[model samples]
Target: MKPAELRNLGIGAVLVALAAIFPLVNDGYWLSIATTAMMYIALSTSWSLFSGPTHLIALSTAAFFGIGGYLVGTGMSDYDTSFWSMAILAPLVATAVALLIGLATLRLSGVYFVIFTLGLAEMIRNLVSWVQNNFLGSRGLYVLTDFTEAHIYWMLLGVSVVVFLFGWWINRSRLGFALKIIGNDEEVARHVGINTAWSKVILFMSTGFFAALIGAIVAPRYSYIEPNVVFSPQLSFLVVIMALLGGTHRLWGPLVGVIPFTLAWEAISVSFPNSTTLFLGLSFLIIVYVLPDGFTGLLEKFTRRAAK
Candidate 1:
């Protein structure tokens, strides 16, 4: 297998191990942390498709993921949408929405794109509020009245697997090559006749799909969905921090980030009780400023040098 293929397989193995082991080692506290981490993995991995590969740092990833949460939430409560069906449909719907977002904003790159996506997230959040207030007659929606944490765990695991595999697939394909080019230089990529617009659309759409899939799972897990939780500025920050801190495009980066960050978050919350968010903020800031490629990138570099 090529290096990318090997990397992908290694990641898959790690995820499988995590899924199998989490239930055994995880209590309510740990399980909650693990599921949140998995959600981060899904969100971050997808964002990496655009931000890491295409160098199009989209800030609106939260919008797509939040939309996913609402998608399955509304489907379940108001529309009688089955969990299984929304599980299948949320990603697709999110992708379609992302396609429009990508196209409308494809002309921008780097920080510009990032800002645009931020605006998009805000817009979506407001839209969610309006819809809920007018249609649902509330500011949030809820799902499961009663369900097992294990069910949430399994569903999160399965969706995380899907997103991880999708990232692996894209990282090895023609589109991936196109994205690498876009990452390096959009002008050069355009000169090379790559359909920059289409690639952008596809990248956003792909990421949006997984983001939404995670959302579907998220709504059910909480049995509630609120605009802020779904589309919060903090949501975007968390995923971006995870991706950037974990080596962005590397196969194991998301998992690396999700695992440690989740653990730290839980630990800090338990120990400090009152300063959990403060702890996460400080950790991410330190990680970004000191080791932007994340711990996984450092590990990968050491591994490669050792191999040499």
Candidate 2:
């Protein structure tokens, strides 16, 4: 590896080590906040792994995430299945769904793709709600578990670490190069012999898998799972905003955006619960207008200027 790559790896290791100490040293509100941050870190990072290179703004995160949560909820509540089994099955189910969705929708690009993905979560939520009401005669499931907040935090943190490592590997691999080419120009990528469709589908599946796994791991925290709550469209928007704010061009960029945005969002949710959506809208606008490339992009510019 180059010197810069080695330095980045060292920095990542240090940051992960520091994050691992949060649950050990804290509890209650702060630990919960850290856990939420970890969740976004994983979500946004995995999100960028696909969206960053493809430049396809997908808003189907909540769809896959809800699938995982609902699976775990149904398994534990209805089938008396173990948490581990549900968790394992969640990602597989999500991957399969992503394959179907990607095959159907990856051909579309720009705003058409964005609109379709945004609608996907709502469609899935309504479908799940209908099934529950008609067949099960229930609207929600209770996820009772012995796992504590700390356990959730650790699991989220572990997922974040894995995502970052995997992203790093992808960024250095040929697939990543192909993705960049696709993002630059699909026609050019095709001319160069890149299998654009499968490349995109593969990355999209990865995002779905991680999102679902995280959803499964965090299901017990809700205790009561409903389609609307688990499949909130807000989750999709938040992931997009967080990834964009971090500047998805670099693997570690989402972490930069997730930390501060998550903290500020927590405050906003508590202090102004009624206007959280308004604030979310405003935040997205600000990020787009002021920091289109995100904090990482700004930092890169500053670094280059300083070097000169």
Candidate 3:
């Protein structure tokens, strides 16, 4: 493996090792935080699949994410489906939604793409709210399942690791190189005969797969699914923050992003509460202007400079 790839693997190994004892080392406080952090990490990695690889800043990430949770909760409880079985169903459902979304919005570009995605997410949220109110008899439908926290926790961690590796694998593939080109210059990519339209489809669908998967597994963890929470812009912000903080369009960008960013959210929410958005926005602005490589990029640059 190249140094970057090896570094990624090494970090994954350390995280896995730490998670092995996370449940044992303390009370629910640490484990719960770790679990939450890891979920965001997984979600962030999912968004990176499209945004980093294929040059799409999809704001409709929460649509499929919430859909995942609804699939598991509604399916397992209302339809009498199994947990593991629904996990499989969740991604497929999300993929279908993503394909439809891609077809609808693929022709849109830049800020227009972002706006269309947001519109789609809002539409889904409102539609789900109606279903919850009229069809599901309100209270957002509680999912009765036997899956334990540890079961879900371990599964999330495994998936987070897998998602991280998935991003790295994309970095190494010809498709990934193609994505880089498209992201850099769609004109050049088009000149080279790259299928920009289809790539965006693949990109968005892949993102939906994981985002929906995380949303699905986590919904059961809550045992209740709400339309607003499921299709939250906060979730979108968290994913974007992870990618930006880590360094966008790179393998480890989102990986570098989740740790400090998650901790910051937890800490500030406890203290400042309402002002957290302001703080987050300021940090993001600074990062974009001053440290475009993200925190990880900065470290790598310093390491190189120090070596010289």
Candidate 4:
């Protein structure tokens, strides 16, 4: 294989080993931080899968994630379902919702898609909130599971690995090529016999499914979740910012983006508490102005200079 391909394979193998080994060695604070970081990595990477290739800025992460959490919450509380089944059911449920939304909105281009996705997430949030207030007495949902922190860490790690591999596969596949063409110009892609609509729908559904899966796994980790927390638009925005700030074009960019930002975020949250969001927002603005291509682009520039 070529040197670059070999390097990527080596790196992937190392990452997989590290993820598998982490939970075994650490259990307290470090495990919690690592688990949260892994969750963000999965989330950002999943967002990048479709957004990077298609140039469609999606804002529906919370919609699917919140839905999955609620599904698991209700299923366990009301119907006596198991965590194992909820994992499968959550993604399936999100995929179905994604398919309908994708079919309706994927045909629209540019800002319209973004607006629809953003609006859809908010709409769902409000609907769920209303349901909680009237029918469920505004008590919100409590996710109960017997899984330990190690189990949760492993689950999130597994999802992160799958998301990474899926991103790598897409980067090398026919779908990737079509997406590149679509990203450049959807009309041109369609004229060239690529089914852009269906391609986009597939991407949408895949992202929705995995985002939901992450939510399902993460929900039980949290003691309680209301619509405001689970369906927060800020969650959608955070992943988008993480992916963009990391560089969305490359498969590894989001993962790179998640690590440093997550660490920094944790530090800032501890130090300033109330100022965490303020600092994060400011940093994002700086990143947009200074590192348009993100840290990956910065790394590439340095590597080329070193080669020279």
RMSD of each: 2.8, 1.1, 2.3, 1.8
Q: Runs in model 1 with CA error above 4 Å?
A: 2-11, 14-18, 25-27, 135-140, 145-147, 271-281, 300-308
Checking candidate 2 for backbone clashes, the offending pairs are: none
| Ordering by lDDT | 2, 4, 3, 1
TM-score: model 1 vs. ground truth:
0.87
Better of 2 and 4 by TM-score: 2
Give a tens-digit lDDT track for model 3, residues 1-308: 67976886787699688886677776477777777877877888778778875556777767788888877877776777787788899999999988987887785676667778767767888887787678877464677677667667777888887887777777778777788888889989999999888877887888889988888888877877667777776677667877778876565577678888888889999999999889878877887798776877888899999999
Which residue pairs in candidate 4 collide?
none
lDDT of 2: 0.91
Residue-wise C-alpha lDDT for candidate 1, range 268-298, written one tens digit per residue: 7778889967875886778768887787878
Clashing pairs in 1: 245-294
lDDT of 2 at 110: 63
Query: Candidate 1 vs candidate 4: which has greater TM-score?
Result: 4
| Candidate 4 lDDT, 1-308, residue by residue in tens | 78999898898999789888988898999999998888889998999999987878899999999888877887777577887798789999999999998888888766778888887778998887787678866375667778888898899988988888887788788998899999998889999999998998998899999999999999888758677777777778878878888998888899888888888888988988999678868877877799888889899999999999
- The TM-score, computed over Cα atoms with residue i paired to residue i, of candidate 4 is 0.94
Whole-structure CA lDDT of model 3: 0.78
Q: Summing lDDT over every window of 10 consecutive residues in candidate 1, give the lowest-scoring window.
A: 138-147
Pairs with backbone N, CA or C atoms under 3 Å apart (clashes), candidate 3: 68-216, 69-216
